[model samples]
Target: MTTTLECRGVTAGYLKERPCVRDVDLTLAAGEITCLLGPNGAGKTTLLETLAGLLPHTGGAIEVEGAPVRSGRPRDAVRAGMVLVPDDRALFRQLSTKQNLLLAVPERSRRSSALKQVLQYFPALEKRLSVDAGRLSGGEQQMLAIGRAILQRPSVLLIDELSMGLAPVIVTEILEVLRRLATAEGTSVLLVEQHVHLALGSADRAAVLVHGRIADRDSAAALRADPGRVERAYLGTDAA
Candidate 1:
């Protein structure tokens, strides 16, 4: 199988502290949704950050399409076809949705209808394009954030917290959009999700992260039936 993203021995953390991610190894295949599950502070977000080059690795390597990428150089990572759609979306709050897309790809002219392609996958965002980015609801903002991430047709898409603080209905909608992207665009995805059940619902497989290391990996359906396996990996002991 051709892996789009691979990490081996990635160790990273805040300054003067134990590494939040230590000796981590993972692979995301093309056209796959690989969910990441862990308890809070298990370094889920930290791993994502490290892989995106937002955080420097104290040890190990990150490779995209088999070429090594240096750590702590986020812009280079983006240029290498890896896109991280952070929980915060990083949209221009003052800008309209269309304007945000405009900035996503400066070289591509006449992308005015870019929102249409986004809407085909996330209909909820279609109706919110003209409005200021800050006014959209949490789910809508996530959709917009994800839409903008895909504007450049990244080879790998990293998402942190797909269902955070959103209504159940909204999460379902976003999952559908993610599904379409994975299927239609052949984008490799890595997700750090708190809502285990929801993430597993749409993913093909998931890696359980515990205190900055991979503890278990299984198919999404199998993980769904017993996510407590993941629960135990991150929560210190076996779950009841």
Candidate 2:
């Protein structure tokens, strides 16, 4: 099967001399949801950022649909059909929700299509279109951020910490949308999440990152079936 995204021995960090993530090899298949789980400082964000072309990779390569993606070139990544939705939401706080989402489609002719698609997934946004993004609830802001990303029609979506600072109900709602996108739209997703069980529950596969490397990779069902193993991987005891 062709992979939507592939990272081969990718190494990157904030400092050029000191790499945070090293020799990470990961892949996301089409229409699959891959959950990345790890504790704080595990370099999960570094890996995602590197994959998204926001950070330079000092070694190895990243490929989207069998083509090389230039490291540190975010626009090139977007052109390659990859999009990253960071934990910050990256919404224009002062702008109304409609204006914020409309920005996703630069061409005025495509703005309606973009808005329609986003609203299809997040109907709640239609009523709140006139409201400022900052004034919306946390979940609503997240929905808008994700809706904006989806408007880009990316082949691979890298979502960083979708569950951060949101209620479980809201998280569930977002996860459900992701599941549908993966299944119905054939959009591959790489999700970094703190809620291990919730992520593992919705994901097709899960990878545990420890000390900037993948400690274990397995089917989500298998991981859920043997959570003690996942715990060991999370605690960095698997290698001991």
Best by TM-score: 2
Clashing pairs in 2: none
lDDT of 1 by residue, 2-81 (tens): 79999988889986378888899889898899999887888999988888889999899999999888889998788777
Top candidate by lDDT:
2
Each candidate: what lDDT?
0.84, 0.92
**All candidates' TM-scores?**
0.94, 0.97
* Colliding residue pairs in candidate 1: none
Model 2 residue runs over 4 Å out of place are none
Quality of model 2 by C-alpha lDDT? 0.92
